[model samples]
Target: MSTAQLQYQSQSVAKPYFIAAIGLFVGQVLFGLIMGLQYVWGDFLFPEIPFNVARMVHTNLLIVWLLFGFMGAAYYLVPEEAERELHSPKLALALFWIFLTAGVLTIIGYLAVPYATLAKITGNDILPTMGREFLEQPTITKIGIVIVALGFLYNIGLTVLSGRKTVINVVLLTGLVGLAVMFLFSFYNPENLVLDKYFWWWVVHLWVEGVWELILGAILAFVLIKTTGVDREVIDKWLYVIIAAALITGIIGTGHHYYWIGTPSYWQWLGGIFSALEPIPFFMMTIFAFNMVFKRRKQHPNKATVLWAMGTGVMAFLGAGVWGFMHTLAPVNYYTHGTQITAAHGHMAFYGAYAMIVLTIISYAMPKLRGIGTAMNDRAQIVEMWSFWLMTVAMVFITLFLTAAGVLQVWLQRYQPNPMPFMAAQDQVAIFYWFRELSGVVFTLGLLLYILSFFIKGKQPAAQPTAA
Candidate 1:
């Protein structure tokens, strides 16, 4: 097989991080399936893996794997964008193992030990940072994460500062730094429920809706410049517009979460207006993607990467922009709060915006990393494209099914004059849960195919004649 020369040797360190991200992504999806089953079957996992445990694992794995993907992306692109080798490839590799081990041990602790016992043993009482939804990692594990994050930021930060300063590198570095800072809120769990929930959004809402958009825009711009052959100036302008809109709306959009959480009544107006405007950046991203592709200067051989890039734009708009708008208004959200409606938005938003961007980078960079060429062979590309459609379509149906269930839940439990009990309303929506489970099964199959594509061999090139 023909191999292309890698631009930088230190970029090779990203391979393990990407590999770990994919592996943990598989774990996340499996736990998702388990939780989906438990929703309808009630006792499916029984004593072994209860719904709460499955949910904790599912959400935690999603966070951990996405972090891996982000780190891998930074390692891969920062060196090239900076026009130099990584500042510390050795540190990058060391952090990868540290993160992987800490993540695995944390997950095991969740599964093997009960939450209360695990908390006690892990010294949560001393710090009391355990048991919050999505922030369930033991205090010790959280500290480990902080250490790893600081080391990672130090490595990437130095590399970017020393090299050529490009918009892409600067934006990515800014987002990463914000990510680390926002995570500190998880440790500041106050006794007041309102305050705890308030700051929780700093890490959750701000990461996904705020700084992560910067990361997403930067990655998309880089891919567009490469695949579409668009000039960096054109892409940089679009990126600036998108991230500006994202920050303006996203920071104020934090009020949307404050509406019912014992916050002031003014939040109803502030959150409603700002959150409604939150879709603008995502919509611009969709337009930017198609505009660049339509104006492409060259036909890139890596059709699969291009497809993922386009899908990220469209799906993100539909998921984060459209669906989010459906229930973001305080009045509307009052009815849908904590219902399956929220689940609908989360399912697609995370997959389309964060997960797809991560996979897009991997798709574009993996072939180069493996010395296989600019892209995978036609066969592998075809399989990968298939996996993309399968997973994407499955997630759509999952969101639809959940939305249907949420509508019924709101009507039966909240809107009606005579509301049913929570369990009773759940019984009315069992069919949708069953449908969601089926969609989850298809999604898992797609993920399996995606992993399989990595192993599929392409045709070998004939050898050149030996020198006399």
Candidate 2:
């Protein structure tokens, strides 16, 4: 097939964004390793970088890179899905640099000065959205985010609205719009601690469990249709069904975070019931992915991308669904609320769902972006696959070790009659922290290999049949 005939010119806008995403992803992993070590060493960076600063950078980078991935995915897909070019490729490019510059500056501010100094320098006292967990971005930075999101939405919205409005494109647009809208709530941080916590979940939980799932679904559907040569009609209908299932369970599942807060007592049952069902959509996603691949009409040469897509389905279910359900119950959460179990679920869930999906899209899209044929060559792909297993396995061990630590900590500190003090409990769980840190090191190695695979030169593999 001719490259021009098969590719959209507007898709080129995504290349830079993906490149930035990968670069930030590496930084995120490195910071992650640093934080993991801080868990065991306590004084690894101490007053210089501090565990909290490293953690904030690690998490904030994760969110920023994922946003970059989402934007890239939209830029790449909207044109094709709409059967027309982007409304403003130049605008897209402009926003790309704007967002990237803003991100780098914010990160520099984060590292170069104390957070308080950074906040004062950024004028956080003007609106005071700082010091609130995930809303740590200065108010000015938050406004920048909103402006960027608006520009993004406008660009994507016009393209989708102007051309074909396929199920996938419409869903993606809606999700992006919803994401921006929910983020606005972060600016409304009242002084009441209960009220503060109450609305915090709106930005956090709603994005991850709600609109983000829609984004994930649409991207997965697009990839499946392209790679599997599945009927668009069939796949489109399934997209609606999957998204519907996601919203039905996930919206109510937001109640899960309300239990311990100063909210109504009935939230326990509501959260338990709804969050338990939240896994249904993820499970359906797994089945939908495999079934589509099994019934594929074409043998796509990019086996690595196929692996990524399928892995997103399976790992998202296991990490976000199964592990989430393990403690989402109000009773279980009451004990494991702030424990390492939450950390375990969080690490796995974010990696399995969001990180993996972004990587899946990039894996499928990058070769074409680079004009390197349908995918990376067999040798590079083999190395990429190796990184995938190494990272995935390392994450599994990290989660397990954290869970073990959490269980022991809960038993010794929370559940025991003569409960140990918090610091003593931490000391008791030090071994598990050591294990988690080691696993993080392995995860970093895997990440390094992943970066290296892109540079490997090798012959492209012939198309292989989809597995039975």
In order of appearance, the predictions have TM-scores of: 0.97, 0.97
- lDDT for every model? 0.93, 0.91
Candidate 1 RMSD to the real structure: 3.5
RMSD of 2: 1.7
Clashing pairs in 2: none
Q: TM-score of model 2 relative to the true fold?
A: 0.97
The per-candidate count of clashes, in order, stands at 0, 0
lDDT of 1: 0.93
Can you give the lDDT of residue 299 in candidate 1?
Answer: 78
